[model samples]
Target: RHYGIVYDNLVAAMRAELPKTVRFVAGRVSAVEAGPERQRVSIIGQPDVTARLLVLATGMGDILRRDVGIERRFVHQRQSLTFGFNVRPAGASAFKHPALTYYGERVSDGIDYLNFFPAGGVTRANLFVFREHTDPWVKALRDRPRETLIETLPGLLKTFGDFEVIDRVSSWLTDITVAENCKRDGVVLIGDAYQTSCPAAGTGVSRLLTDVERLCMVHVPQWMASPGMAAAKIAAFYDDPMKQAMDERGLELANFRRSLTIDTDLRWRARRQVHFSRRRILHEIDKFSPSFAARLRGLKRPQVEAVT
Candidate 1:
């Protein structure tokens, strides 16, 4: 299934029902002042409303994080052109099975993982080429996105055969990548606000939603029931859970990033050792239960319950 299509359908469904139950507040949150019983959230437009609980889903904004003294580790520069192509099978040859191919060297090289998926009768492939954050090429063509796309597309075509470009996407400069220990007192950070991970791991959106759901379903309800739930209590409820989730994801992302992006020769050797060790661990797990590998494969299915 195309995620873009599914996302559009989901958005359409939400848009249809949004006006009925949810009130739309279209202004910026200027300030958040915590009090004894409720939080006084000051908005640019509305001034008279106060709530017992405040949920800020205001994604990865540096200004908001700075206000609460949360600093990030990895700088959130944009990932240069990761190209997607929709290819029609050439002549007598047909794609037998979909596969993800990882190519090139550890740190300085490009094309980390290229995924080929069945699209209708054709093949839709996405090529992820790693461009360094400090590269001069990225700096020169940063402002002109189309020029960057033009530069990256030819290389992708040469490596992966000729295919038509479907869509292109890039990350924002202001999008934050924070360290494991970045959390605040009064305000609760969820999603990308807490920590940003590399897209290579493919866990960012899932992790974010899981954090939100855990807080809303378990923690927030419990906090509401407490007799003396102050701002400190609310902060505590969010702190541990958010921190644990972010740390686990952050470590995984860092490992994955280091494996693909580190430029040092020594770091390459270290990553090779880590990769071999990880494979050995997997092999040992497979030996324990023959179906362990199969079950692990099944975990990638859409219906599988993700770890919170």
Candidate 2:
């Protein structure tokens, strides 16, 4: 059983609704000053633009954060590596399922998971590995992806049917980080500009979406109505309850996923065994009797989990 979502089209659909006031600046920011009343933004090849408030949605690699005394504290220097490629059915037959997920079976494999799904008239394959970028296994996966993946995940071929690699593997090395001492005057940090998420955890977009909703839909309008854009006003957005909860959940999930995949301790090892055992038992029950499975769903366990 597997599930997946396509984000590229969703992004394109959202961009279609952008207001006319949203102008795209095509230049490097030479200087940024978070003034008490307004922000003085200077671009290398464009005229300076002053605004009552400035939001930094720049990525983790952005260096403009230094001017505002915001520094990234690396939580896990290199948390996970992600590989992306396109996969198509190898034979005349099509795959039974539109989307499929394959979780790593062994701790020693260092392979977290793999997802295959339909997107843009083709099937996309994404693999998440809890291994170093320079490791021999990582290099092997990059050079000979099909052969290496087949060897690593023997059940993959049987589960999803034969598939041919249709594109080059795109890889990403994620460094989990959180911004520190970012509370300043007029400028506010959001999305990857404030924190970097582990690709394996799948919390990156959730945190960023929360940031955008809390900042734009709620905080920004309220802040603009006030007299000055000072540190006091900026701190209010950081103290937002929804934003705080999402940030905490992202970090918690990062640790939980890493431990679930690689932790070989006694408790985690036992937990993993029980986790898969439960899923298997429920799946069996569903196959034999759907009504009986529905009865089990209401007993002590979550309806979704028991049914799943």
Candidate 3:
């Protein structure tokens, strides 16, 4: 019911499907000049190029964004850490489970969860944690990933069967940010350029896709049918109802994940208990009365509303 694919492979597949008329210039962008009717781009070792509009997808790169006078407001600094690596059964040829979500066993660990899923013919492990990037434990995990994982997650070996990390560990530190002063003539920001999401929140791609759909299908045609691409024209896309709701939901989910994992308040402590208890109950119910469990799952539960 769930699936995973390599990010680069997905991009390559999409690139291959693009129309022949679409051109991709390979060079570092050095400067940008945006205006009411035209946008100019200057790339290193390349001739200047101009277009009617610019859709920037430069993820977290601030040079061009700053060149155009856009600023970033950090919602949360060093919000979370994500680690990725390939894994395979140690002595056996297969694993006990196809996919697994292992929740952190201790609060002091600051680990949110470890996910194991099949992608690109290999079992990939993605670990999400709420911890300082400079922490000694983080260094230890990178230096001796297999040992550190087994020692920290003792049940992982038993739950998923013995496995060995087969590749270099890759780590990323995420900061939740949103662009400011982005409503400008001849330019628009989408995905991480407009806003960054917590990887644990699982909303980055959704937000990006939503932006593309609304901009391309809803706003672009309307804007092109008229005259100059002014700031007023760009503001409509930023103020789109669906896009605003999705962006707000991303922030809400990002905060909820952090609080659920690390907050030691009385309310969260009780909520945490209820959360795990419900999951355990559901697992047990499904094992015996799957049809009844399906009905219970079909019942709408309360949404995770944002708190001030």
TM-scores, all models, native as reference: 0.61, 0.88, 0.94
Model 3: ten consecutive residues of lowest lDDT: 299-308
Report, for all candidates in order, the number of backbone clashes.
Answer: 0, 0, 0
lDDT of 1: 0.54
Instruction: State the lDDT at 224 in candidate 3.
Output: 96
Give a tens-digit lDDT track for model 3, residues 2-76: 477889888889888989999987789899999999999999999999998999999878889998899999999
Model 3 stretches with alpha carbons more than 4 Å out? 289-295, 305-308
Residue pairs whose backbone atoms clash in candidate 2: none
**What would the C-alpha RMSD of candidate 1 be, to one decimal place?**
7.0
lDDT of each: 0.54, 0.82, 0.90
Error of 3 at 294 (Å): 4.2
Better of 1 and 3 by lDDT: 3
Candidate 2 lDDT, 31-78, residue by residue in tens: 788877979888997899889988887777667888877888888888
Highest lDDT against the true fold, candidate: 3
